[model samples]
Structure formats: C-alpha cells, structure tokens
Target: MQSIVLLLWLALCAEQDVRERQIANTLTLGVGLCALIFLFVTGHTWIGSDAEEAGWALAFVILLTIPGYMLGQFGAGDVKLLAALALATDRQYLLGTIIGSGVALVLWLLSRRWLWSLLSQKVKNRLKAWGDESSKKQPFAPFLLAGFLLASVWIH
Candidate 1:
C-alpha cells in the first residue's frame, strides 16, 4: 500500500515536471513527512531520530539532484521525489534504490544526449558541450517508477 502510494506520487510528480518543469513544495513535503510518520508509527525506524533519518534522506536526494541540476537535466521535484523515496525505504533499501535510480539516470541521460546529437550540427555541438535545458514532454516518471519497483523486487 505504501509502495503503491509512493509509485503514484512519483508518477504524479514526474507528469507535473514533464508538463511544467516544476513541482510544488507542498507535495514533496507532504510525502516526506507522511513517510517519516508512517515509518515511526509502524515501529520500523531508520536510524537515529526520525527527523535525523529524514534529514539523511533529504541529503541523499540532494546528492542525486546535484548532477541533474548542474547539467540542467532535472528539477528540484525530482530531487524531492527521490528524497521521499529515501525516507520511505530508509537505510535498509537505500542502497538498492541508489543503485537502481543511478542506473536509470545514467541511461536516461545517455539516451537524451544521443537523441540530441542527431539534431543539427550546431545544436548537437551545443548539446554535447552543455546539453539542452529546454523543457519538453517526456514522461520520466515511468523510469523512476521502474527503478523503485526493480529495487524492491531485487533487494526485498
């Protein structure tokens, strides 16, 4: 049930990002908070205090976000989504998700660049140098959803 909601949240976040290149802070905060509370209520804590665990998850999300934000690859929402996932999964599943999302992110970036290289020479060169920061219609939520699912399947 939690996983399903997490997947749905990621899907919604992805759709919003693909459509608008932005995600509301309320949504991310709500999910992160809820997950933390749920974990605590369920007596399945991560490490330290819940607040500390949430902070750690947020840090992990920020770490993943740096590259994407630096290369103009993704938005803060993506980072928040990953952060929420990190909180939900906690330390136990963190390793799997990191591996899963990392793999997906690499593949996604490579493919996006490969397609960009097929554009005009000038555009291709520019893309090869700095990459496109343009907003477009691509559903990336599915990839994230897949990553979470795959990690859950393999790790658990």
Candidate 2:
C-alpha cells in the first residue's frame, strides 16, 4: 500500500522533473511526508531506532549524491528525492534504493555523449537552455526516477 503510493508519487515526480526540469515543492513535500509515514507505520521510525536507520540510509544516499551534485552530475532535486526516500522507507528499501540510484548513475554516465550533443544543439540554436546550473549539461531526473521506480518493486 505505502510502497505502491510511494512508487506512484516517485514516477509522477520524475515525469514532472523530466518534462519541466524542475520538481514542485508540493510533490517533494508530499512524497517525503508519505515516506516518513510509511517508515513510522512499519516501525522504522522518524524519531527512534528507525529514525537512526533512516539517518544511516540517508547518509548513504548523500554519499552518492554529493559527488554528483558537486561534479554537476545531478541536480539538487535528485539528492532531495533520495533523501525523501530515506525518510520514508525502511533500511532494506533504502539500500535497494541506493543500488537503484547507482544503476541510474551508470546509465546516465554511459549516455553522456548524447547529453553533450543535445546541449550543443541547444546552444548552437541559441535556444533558452533550461536548468543550466553548471557549465556542463546534465540529464536531470530521468535516471533518479528510474532507480526509485525500479527498486520500489522490492517493497511489496
């Protein structure tokens, strides 16, 4: 039930980010809250051992995300998405989520050449380049969402 809802919400958020390159605060907040509730209900905790477990899981997510965020590999939304999942799910789910994100990261890196071409085309046409946070271009949300959605199958 909670897993299904989280998966749906993750998919929706990923679509929204992929389409617009911006994740809505409402969606982020809603998803985070839902995950937290899921954790609590499962005895995972937002305030106790579960909370500590979540903290550890979140730390792992952060370890993966920080490099991406710093190296211009991913956006803040991606990191936040992982953090939200850490808050919402149990350690098992959280670890699975990390593995999923890692898979997404690999996919994104493998597709880097295409990303460069896309950026070059946009720049060559002098089109309004969106989400241009770094000098290098990035494929923002697709992979992160892919990871979350894929790993979510383990939840049930």
Candidate 3:
C-alpha cells in the first residue's frame, strides 16, 4: 500500500517536473509531514521499520543534503523527497537511494547527449520545442524515483 503511494508520488513529481520544469513544495511537504505524523502515532512508518531518533535522522539528512541543493546540484524537491523517504525508511536505505539516483543521473546525462547528437536537424528542432537541448537542463525527479524504488527493493 505504501509502496503504491510512493510510486504514485514519484510519478506525479516526475510528470510535473517534465511538463512544467517545476516541482511543487506542497507535495513534498505534505508527504513528509504525513509520514512524520504516522511515525508519531504508530511508532512505525508506512514502509520501513520503526524509526530510531527519527527527528535527529531527518535533521541530519536535511543538513547533509542542503549543500547539494545550495549548489544547484538538485532542487529543493529532491531534498524534501529524500528527507521524507528517510522518515519512511532508515539511513541505510537512504544511502542506497542516493547511490542509485546518482548512477542513473550519470547514465542519463551521457545517453541523452549521445542520442541528441545522432538526431537530424528537423528532429532536433521539433525536440527543442519540447525543451530538449543536448546541453540544456534535465529533470532529476525521474532518476530519483528510479533510485528510490531500486534502493527500496534492494534494501528490503
């Protein structure tokens, strides 16, 4: 049940970002807060085991990821989503998620550039309107979702 919701949330976030180049804070915050509330009331998350010092864990994660956010390496949405996942899982799972996301991002960047280079001018022009610039920005939510799901599966 929780996995289904998480997958849906990831999909929604990715779709919003790809379509609008923006992510909503409401979604991230709402998920995080709900998880926090669930933890407080039930002593366990919807997905993972009972959190030990969950507040400290959340704070640590936010602090740890903030530098990347500040450097524009990722959006605030990524940070919030990770923190929320931390609430849903444990530190070990979060590490796996980060690693998986990083690998996917690197591969995506390489493949996208290579594919763009192979496209014809007409195709490139059409794709450009869809915001496909080989050297331009790319969305991270999909990669994050991939990593999150992969990590969740592997960790469990």
Candidate 4:
C-alpha cells in the first residue's frame, strides 16, 4: 500500500511536470492527505520507522534544500514535493531523496540536448507549448521519482 501511494505520487508529479510545468497545490495537498490516510489506516507504523521524528526530518530537509530553491535553482514545487516525501519517509530516505534528485537533475542537464533530439517533433512542440522555449531545464519530476526509488532501495 505504501509502495502504491509512492507510485501514484510519482506518476502525478511526472504528469504535472510535463503538462503544466508545475505541481499544483492541490496535488501536493492530495499527496499529503493520502499519506495521512495511509498512516491512519496502518496505525502510523507502516510508513516509516520513526513517525515521531518526521517533523524534524522535514525541517532539516527543508533547511538544507530551501536555499537552492531561493537561489532559483529549481522552484517551490520541487521543495514542496521534497517536504511531502519527507513526511512519507524517514531521515535516511529523506537524505537519499535529496541526493537522488540532485543527481537526476545533473544527469538531465548533461544529457538534455541528446534527449531532446530523441523526442518526436510533435512531442517537442507539445513540450515547447508548455513554455519550454529553450528545450533546456527539463522537468525534475521524473528525475526526482527515480531518485526517490533509488534512495528507498539503497539508502536504508
């Protein structure tokens, strides 16, 4: 059930990133609600080892990452997404999330041109319509998702 929720969250993030280039507030709220529901259903024991420490973990993650956001490295959506994920995970996994997302962004930046060339013209045009003027700055959702998965598996 936790895995299912994670997958759903990742899918929604990816979809929103591609089409809207932003994660709607409602989407983040929905993800948080789902996490809360899952916690409620499972007696809050299934999601993470230390549910009590999540708040601190969240603050820690935010403090470490918010600087990047404020510096215009990404956007508020990404920060909010990370916070939501922090709620769903423990400290180690949260660290994994940060590292994984960062690595994903770097890799995407390095391979963007080749990846863009691989996209079909129609897809490119659609992406461009979503305000992708330079075809750079690819969405971070997919990379974040990948990072989340990797962190979940390898970090703990």
Model 1 stretches with alpha carbons more than 4 Å out: 45-59, 62-74, 109-142
The CA lDDT of each predicted structure is: 0.64, 0.67, 0.76, 0.72
**Candidate 1 per-residue C-alpha lDDT over 48-147 given as tens digits, one digit per residue, 9 for 90 to 100:** 2355565566677777677987787766666676777777766445556667766886787778767665689865553332344563534445467667
Give every collision pair in model 4: none
Q: Which residue pairs collide in model 2, if any?
A: 35-88, 44-50
Question: Best lDDT goes to which candidate?
Answer: 3
Cα distance off (Å), candidate 3, residue 84: 1.6
lDDT of 2 by residue, 1-156 (tens): 656666777777767775567678678766777667767677664323466788777788788789988987777777787788778765677677667867876876787557656676656344233334353554455555666666767554
Candidate 3: give the clashing pairs: none
TM-score-based ranking: 3, 4, 2, 1
Instruction: Tell me the lDDT of model 1 at 106.
Output: 73
Candidate 4's C-alpha lDDT? 0.72
Worst 10 residues of 1 by lDDT: 126-135
Q: Write the per-residue lDDT of candidate 4 for residues 23-134, one digit (tens) a residue.
A: 8877776776666566566545236556665666678768987898888777778777877776676677778776887887787768777888898988887766334546
Q: Give all TM-scores, in the order shown.
A: 0.60, 0.64, 0.79, 0.78
Backbone N/Cα/C clashes per model: 0, 2, 0, 0
TM-score of 3: 0.79
Model 4 lDDT-worst window of ten: 129-138
